[model samples]
Target: MTTEPPETGLVVRYSFLWPREHDRGEIEGRKDRPVCLVVPVDVGQGAVVVFPITTQEPLPGRSAVAVPDTERRRLKLPGDRPCWIMLDEANSDVMPGSYHLVPLETHPLRYAYGRFSPAFMRVVLRTMGESIRARQLRMVPRER
Candidate 1:
């Protein structure tokens, strides 16, 4: 339970600002939600990127990876509905002092809920990579 996110694949409660919201002139997320940290592309540089997780079904044409039931049980995510890791966009923030990384109310002293399994993360990363190569990835800056 660290105050700062130390690695990738950690599921954290964050104020995730979506691409649509950003386009509508919203600087902050509509609400705090569960997000997965799938890539540690530049940990030493403090640039952490995260993909939002939602129980809502992905819109048509958007890319996403389904979260398995076992994974959901391990993480104790609320509800019994299906969840998906939206891969069409990501948010970047400087770690150790990110404005959008909110502490989980259930784990007040920690910034993360838990880490995703390596296997699941692999699937997520692969989908994200495809999005990246196809140039469908949108990077929204969340740093102040």
Candidate 2:
């Protein structure tokens, strides 16, 4: 028996939030601290993906995880900090919710299951961005 490879260009929505001052102590000294945010997409909605920007290689196979635009503006992520925007086509049953930071160093192999090329990932990001923009336009209230 053989398993099919994951699909490419699956559009998944994700949101990321940083920890408050109170929570800083919990992740002291850790750079890529686990963050919790919302994923609007549902299982089988399309595919799971992430947009991670870090100094290290991205964890494989994991779904797309987006870095909050606010964080990007404030921190100005360094280039050496390898940024990853992952997507997972499997496990669509899980609802969009929050996830804690699970150190990549801990489960190197498991996280590095699926990999995507820079060009391919760029295409995916562009497609998703267009879709999001369209959706936002539709929601805008028309002025008479």
Candidate 3:
């Protein structure tokens, strides 16, 4: 399938393969999960930047911005599932599958999935930048 540059803050579903063990660099993520596309459009190579959404809570002292349930409701996500957007390691660059946008009842869906509020996207980016500056993220060097 052909790929296009998805706008930032689109809640797209992707099968993320991330490091489960930093020391081992064991990658995981078999099932498709929701992620926010954070990369600006018309950037570099085909690799897209994204933040994976998860039900797991953030570790203490980590930069994980918990998506408010109100926002989740606005996005038409199940209210029962509390999720955290890992600002620390949630940041990733990968080739994406054909993404499906999650629809919202409160807001208009952008592309195939739903869109995140510009304000919220700003907060995410700012928090991620802070995390990077603080050196809070575990580095897994990729082969160029």
Candidate 4:
């Protein structure tokens, strides 16, 4: 009997909201705007998880947090809701910092922002698949 290898690539989906805070000043100033609830993905081999942010304006100096693979796997991410995937670091050659899945209702704004597109999603998914495939191949035992 022949056995097929386990699927390495795991898809996680969840919802993310950008909170805006304004400071109470003479003219109302804002400070320390950071991204909240970032779950990083570990691709192994020094390649950290990536967070692809698809918003109207790219948050400067803000990044996602890298979480352990075990925690990420165990996380009960909601499929019906929107979510982001930590693929790799922004400096890494694989993927970017963050990718936001805009809700169907907010797709218009997403397009307006010009941060995300169908092509971009395709590339991201392809890269993720490749990473998973690579991991799976490494786990496979050789016939001696």
Candidate 5:
């Protein structure tokens, strides 16, 4: 049975394994960090599509995007930790509990670091689209 995501395009903390890393083996360690749940891959499969987030600034060659400080604050991210979205790396089979979803409303504590606003989602999608078009040479239709 295929399990769908509770919410598509939700940003949460998850441990992601970079598929391209051939040297890494039996890697039981999963790096838990911020990731954007792009879709469920049907928005399902007990799995979802994800874009890894990091604090490392994109260098002259890395295919990553910077998340503005303002947007990061709205996501209730840590003030001390800067964030960058990795456009080249995406995990398509992240399991449930691998990440989280912040709904429209949440408890004060949760809201401090919960599901982000639609506005931010727009920014993510836009950047992801730009990455795809320039790097992948393809077009991605907007979900809505």
Candidate 6:
């Protein structure tokens, strides 16, 4: 893990266990993927939440925000195939202690890929807030 703590909006690689997968008895994510930190800092005592970013298009009834071309380029994400930040669910972990957070293979010492732009982050936060209020958001905790 990096000595520096992660900040809000930082995109980090993580083994994110989806809610459905967890319900099916999976203990870990099948693979590591880029995930965006949603909470500004620790929630409650030390838990932090992050939303997964995916190249797969959001399906019907799912909540997501497309990453604009400019933002994708700025973040150096792969391809032009389109990406979306999934907002319907998130992973919760014990920040500063979770073993799930990982560095990119290309950048061993760094745990972050990049941060989302403030304006775009605002849109994500707003949508996530709505989801939370509507009881549509699911959280999967990664702490043992």
Q: How high is the lDDT of residue 132 in model 4?
A: 56
For residues 81-113, could you state the per-residue lDDT of candidate 3 as single tens digits? 889888766535544334333323343443235
What's the lDDT for candidate 5? 0.56
After superposition on all CA atoms, what RMSD does each candidate show versus the true structure? 2.0, 17.5, 5.1, 17.3, 7.1, 1.7
Q: Higher-TM-score candidate among 4 and 5?
A: 5
lDDT of each: 0.83, 0.32, 0.63, 0.27, 0.56, 0.83
For residues 73-142, write the lDDT of model 5, one tens digit per residue: 7676544677887876676654443333322233322311445567767777777778776774221111
Ranking by lDDT: 1, 6, 3, 5, 2, 4
Candidate 6 lDDT tens digits, 1-144:
454465678888889989999999998999798898865442565567889999999998888899998998898876677899999989987666678977887888777888989999889899888888888889998875
List where candidate 4 sits over 4 angstroms from the true fold: 1-86, 89-115, 136-144
Alpha-carbon TM-score of each model against the true structure: 0.90, 0.23, 0.70, 0.21, 0.63, 0.91
Off by over 4 Å in 6: 40-42
Candidate achieving the largest TM-score: 6
**TM-score order of candidates, top first:** 6, 1, 3, 5, 2, 4
**In candidate 1, which residue ranges exceed 4 Å CA deviation?**
40-44
Of 1 and 5, the candidate ahead on TM-score is 1
Least lDDT summed over 10 consecutive residues: which range in candidate 4?
Answer: 1-10
Model 1, TM vs. native = 0.90
Taking all chains together, the TM-score of candidate 5 against the true structure is 0.63
Kindly list the per-residue Cα lDDT of model 4 for residues 105-132, writing each as its tens digit: 3332321111223444455556555645
Where's the lowest-lDDT run of ten residues in candidate 6? 38-47
Error of 1 at 78 (Å): 2.1
Off by over 4 Å in 3: 1-4, 21-28, 40-46, 94-112, 138-144
